[model samples]
Target chain A: MKIIYTSFIGFVFLIVCSSIIISDLKGPESLILGSWDEVSWEYERVNSTENSNLPLDNLVKKEICSNMFIHEAETWVFKKNNRLQLVKRGHEEEELIYNLRGRGNILEMIHKDNGTEIYQIQDLTKNKLVLHFNFDLQVKGIVKMTFSKVD
Target chain B: MLRKFNNYRTHQDNLKIAILTACSAGMVNVLSVILFFAFTSNVTGHYAILAQEVAKGNWYQAAIVFIWISLFLIGNFTSNMLIIHSKPGKSTYLAHATPLILEIICLLTVSIYLQRFYLNTLWETEFLVALMLFAMGLQNGLTASITNFSIKTTHLTGLTTDLGLLFSMFTKKKYRKDKKLRRKAQILLSVVTAYMFGGISAGILHIKVGYAAFYIVCVLLGIILFYDYSVLKIKRRKRSLFTRKNILFSKKTL
Candidate 1:
């Protein structure tokens, strides 16, 4: 009787671990490739006191601090072969090559001139994507960018 | 249980550590998967991912994976080095407890950082992941060294392989009847079962509590450390009492 109960539990556990592995194996590329509208963006300072004096801080304050870059009809298109298309409201579309790398939740994107952008993929679902990236200010800080899929 | 080291450890001691450490490893690994989408307790999957990156000419990704694997190795090295270099005539429990204390500190740091200021940025996530991998390395090292490599709790690949070999051998009456082999089988079963239970529990808890689930793992390690410390204290008290009685008897004889 004890052996039966124990085996039953083990069998159930095997199923759970197997399911996680299968889900992970599905890959994040498909989930990230579609068009997404930028919903919101914010920066988090790691050392707010020390980095408040940096030039990037002033630039971010003037541009992205109070006013979000939520242009009407803005869409980001991630394509195959490491290509990215950024379309802003009433502006010419910019095409850039990008490489999406890393496994699991830690993802890194390398752009042609932007060097390497590291992002923590907080959540990636069928319709929602949340990303976190950091800037190396004098004291280091992060930016949280959220996007919703555009149909 | 606390004083015994290396060859002097009994089957019961091995079993106790196996169950406790495996459950802890399971919880840590599962929580990491849910929170960071990575495996911090083991490097088996990372090695495969590293190879895949290398094959695709993704040097940056490959380098990250390589560094992660190296951290796990360093963790193991640190734990064993502590165990190997204790001053003679000192309580070995201190040496054994040192690695676990370090593990607790690592987990505690991770828990506090995530709770207060986790921005979910890549560097922050990677930093947390590295700390977790190192903590697990320390744990894996301590358990493996103390048990004479008879038990490893951090990864299931080797455990599953050993289980397969044991079950196949058990089909024969000769292998099943051997006391040592049977004991080994029992130990393996306990470790594997406890590990599964831990993972299942973490899966449920992480959903409800989010990153706070890591604190529970810290508490679990604390329990193990406290248990060992209590046992050491009792052992010391008994030794002192025995010495006092011996001294009184010798004076009377004089």
Candidate 2:
């Protein structure tokens, strides 16, 4: 009886494992691969913008060149040979290279210049992409992000 | 020397039992994540992308999958309680039987609804989630119950951490390793590995076959039921045969 039970379990295990293998091999579109571009971004405050009491319309037109890099650029790139190289001319010198693997349309990338930091592509679409990056503010580390896409 | 050797053998047997428990528990957690990933990423995640529908405030549709999550929680709660309370040997059949019946009814209901009335869009998603929750609950509950508290198949957050502890203890080599602890580690690992593999497989299936994953669950439950019944029938036959032989022997003696 014990032997029977053991064999029965083994049989079930084999069946389940085989099913997974077959499904994994069954398709191509299941692989998320392609070029994606940034459309818009949502940013976290670097410091109290208390210095500026600008109105909403003026704020939209305001592009302050403060030393603090509060905004991040959203960029998309195509991938081949397991590596994704972004085509943005200025950002090319930047460590922001994307790699495609695992599941879905997810991409993993690293900022080369700032080797200390990492970013996760939280969400993406044909027109829009969302990126999350972490930084230290005060004593604690915090996450902030930008959403962007090509018009 | 011989007496001492026998003691060593029992200790070894106990070790195997512990290992199996730890493995099974780990498998449960991995599989749960895998199932969730597969369902959301491949099978049904697309529904959420219907922004137009969402903008219309289709609460019914939005709430459908969540309700399934709720049902699954209910199933787990029930099964966990039942397993914890019931005598180990007596509860195995019940563990497998209850979910099997519930799943079948759910499936039939879905098919009928599709064939007969136009189900509200919200109702359709809710129904699917409910079916999934109930089925998963049964699967996890029965597996957990049969194995006792030693193996949990539905979730793994606890198992992986426990395995880490056991690994450290093994490394320290300070105190005499407890045989009971060793048995637990084995069970936890087996369950954990199996469930993780199951989830990966289910994820792949979700991509290729859609909700047919539920059908597979149904089949596995059926297999479990058949196995339990067959074992019971054999036990009954053996008992009846023993009784007949005893009666004949008494007649001859008389």
Candidate 3:
């Protein structure tokens, strides 16, 4: 009877723990699933010491983002198994492995060719995701990518 | 450093231990930051982050931070507990060394796991942070408790404030002339310098050898253990030899 009571308590504890973990209240990681449409690509200055901040445009993003996996992506689909699919404008898809660090603030995406890129999740909400990254091209500043979740 | 306790510890003993342990703390902190993007040495920032996460409704992240803080507290608790309890063997040095051994084990686990089995998941990173924090807590507890709270090597926020206060006191002639005050200033300065030196070295070493930098931390900790052990052994031998001579002299007189 004592062993049965202990087993019952353990089973209840496990159920409660998993429920809290799987729920969206866990953190930004849960709220970041499904598809997100690319809203805009913006730029911000890193520090006062850095040189004049050149504004980021479509052409500038095209030239500077060769190494960044999200450069040409239109929509990002975060799958269940640490897999991320980047859908390009013409409907081309690129698959990459993604992981979050620093309480889901840092987003690391690893390309199939083994190239990697890191971005800071500046903001994550129920319907919005903002990513911040840096570029050292002719214009040196942080690039901010905003995304709106797709239904 | 490990041999003496409380008021019996000389300034040299405190300074040496502070410098060595602070350097190790600085190195461990930088390595954790570079690898996990988290601070492992101190809990001030973690407390704030915990509150922020909770306020932001990020339960998972908040829970991880809370666990890290709890591990740090538990580590400190474990170290002091070992110190007070291990004296049953009547080995003061061994009692103190016990905490260092536990710290070494904690760091070694992280090092081995990172080298062999780390999958770069969030869980893996959080677990590594927890281990490093516990190790740091063990070190900090050992130093602070043995010194009667004079030397805390794990974090510099309090030390920096103490340094500022010491500098302010040094403006007066009496404070400047006081040997105790002078010794305190010297020790604080040395800790800051050693910590900065260790931090910079870890930065460069990380760039050169990556996560292998943790081995260097393990080596530094080993030196602390070895230094105390060697000193205690020599003292024991000298006491035994002096006792033997006394016995022989008494026999001759008889």
Against the true structure, whose lDDT is highest?
3
- What is the per-residue lDDT of model 1 for residues B20-132, given as tens digits with 9 covering 90 to 100? 88898999998877666678989988988778776865444455566677779879989999988988788788888899989999998998998999754444666688898
Q: Candidate 3: which stretches are off by over 4 Å?
A: A1-33, A43-70, A79-83, A90-95, A111-116, A134-142, B86-89
Backbone clashes for every candidate come to 0, 43, 0
As a whole number from 0 to 100, the lDDT of residue A85 in candidate 1 is 75
Q: Which segments of model 1 are wrong by more than 4 Å? A: A1-74, A77-151, B249-254
Task: Give the clashing residue pairs of candidate 1, or none.
Answer: none
Best candidate according to DockQ: 3
Question: DockQ (C-alpha) of model 1?
Answer: 0.05
What tens-digit string does per-residue lDDT give for candidate 2 at B1-254? 00111133353432332333223323322223332221311223334433433464433222333344445655666655654565656644564465546645554454345446623232243344455456556555544544444444555667688888888888765522777777667667765665566566656665676545545544544554565577678978999999999999999999
Docking class of 3: acceptable
Model 2 residue B140 CA deviation (Å) reads 3.3
TM-score of chain B of each: 0.95, 0.61, 0.96
At residue B252, candidate 2 shows an lDDT of: 98
TM-score of each: 0.66, 0.46, 0.83
DockQ computed for model 3 against the true two-chain complex using alpha carbons = 0.31
Which is superior by lDDT, 1 or 2? Answer: 1
